[model samples]
Target: MTETGESGGRKYDPAATHNFPDERLNAILPDLLSDPEITTYLEAQNVNAVTRKGYNDHGTKHVEIVRNRALNLYDLLKGGDVGFNGAIDQDLDEADEPVIIALAATLHDIGHVVHRDEHVYYSIPLAADLLDRLLPEFGFYDASEAVRMKAEVLHAILCHHTEEDPLTTEAGVIRVADALDMERGRSRIPYEKGGRGINTLSSQAIESVSLRPGDGSPVLVEIEMVNAAGVYQVDNLLKAKLDGSGLENHIRIVAVNTKAEDRLVERIEL
Candidate 1:
């Protein structure tokens, strides 16, 4: 929360909060935001009815959700007693990795501007363009950091949908948050109306979301749905992917009973 410039922007020392420096991340955000192709991608989805809900899925909302979700995941890791697992050292703080997680969360859905079906594909190229633009801004002035940023962002974007993708520490955290999104905070009207089948629409009606920490294992993600349209439809689509995620052993989704139980409903879990 230190401001260094005239614009009053943050002057974060990456080591102050994370292992990576602020210069490294600040160097890349604009690049990620500047690509003409990415701009086009954002513009396309900016108009989608599903994206307009509650000021939570729009421009700032996108990054806001990402930041919150990433931080939450980090906190869950620490609280669940797993933060020190993997490459994490006893003396090192995991919070330092937040910048990478936050940035990835911010950019992961940029591909959604093109299409929602596996936006991860669009995320990769868009991330590359963003890194190209970011290098000069961060005083990298050299190619080394530029290359590093590209690799980092690409890893983050590709792995956000599935945990099987190879990833750095930051990428792994962002991936968990992205998967936990579960359409939890999104509006159901537009999605329910336009979806072709029951599964697609049900998948759209997420109401409550939470993260459960695992003991040196994959995090468990809990999503509660209102199930306004059809429960089974949403469950089938999300379950397959969640199960496929390496987190199947640790990820547990608990669907609570609600009044709108009008479809092929399971009694316990979604």
Candidate 2:
């Protein structure tokens, strides 16, 4: 059921295997994705489309994208000795960092099952319950450790909304990764079906996002756009997310207009 392919010239696979630093996370991700509550939440977005208004998918695919990006950012920052707070800096094992980030990213949007507006607040309790049930399966039999992990993951999930600031490295990674999901496909359905205006137009202009280790920084985020409009997604949305993320200083972001010989429109560094 897993296959690798290119998306906007970048390699991606919906079923890609991520080697989590934590063996517990690696063993549990597949089961978590298949959990009835999680699957139903994702499906509810599309099934109740008429009630929700035209919106980009807030489903499993979106979770996968954010999960991958969050994990990649976490690994890059941790390897560079970027200081992280919350559970990462506390008594938790180093391997637990990726677990926290991945769980936060994966479950961040499930709150949409309640409603989209201010769903971040709703995600907290839902995510906490899921974590409580799932962590024990990952061998987190210690009550204190389970509570710490749930608290950290919920913080990251809560901070993903623009109104909240990420207080930890893992939360920052989740915030930025959530913003990075602004590629065209994300907005295509809404855009095609009368979802007019700046949000849709700007999102459609984005062609791809490529993340890699930077030559001069800990991480590089390269955004490719077909038109100047994509600037809104990068400058307004992504920038806001990164501004509050703790990783700002360790990361550099560049947005290029591919249709214009790769002209750089925005370059930001902390």
Point to the candidate with the largest TM-score.
2
Compared with the true structure, what per-residue lDDT tens digits does model 2 show for residues 161-261?
A: 87888888888989988888888878877877788878889898888787777888888888878887888898899988888777778888888787855
- Least accurate stretch of 10 residues (summed lDDT) in model 1? 3-12
C-alpha local distance difference test of each model: 0.51, 0.76
What does each candidate score in C-alpha RMSD?
7.8, 3.7
Off by over 4 Å in 1: 1-44, 47-63, 81-96, 112-119, 135-143, 162-164, 183-189, 192-196, 212-220, 228-237, 248-250, 260-270
Model 1 C-alpha lDDT per residue in residues 1-270, reported as the tens digit of each score: 232332112222334443323454455456654656555655565444245431224333444455556655554554444332222321222332554565566677776666566667876887677667754555643576446555665776787675445335556566555544445334334444564444345545555555545444445555555655434533554464445444344445666535454444433463
TM-score of each: 0.61, 0.87
lDDT assessment of candidate 2: 0.76
Candidate 2 regions with alpha-carbon error over 4 angstroms: 1-20, 46-51, 261-270
TM-score of 2: 0.87
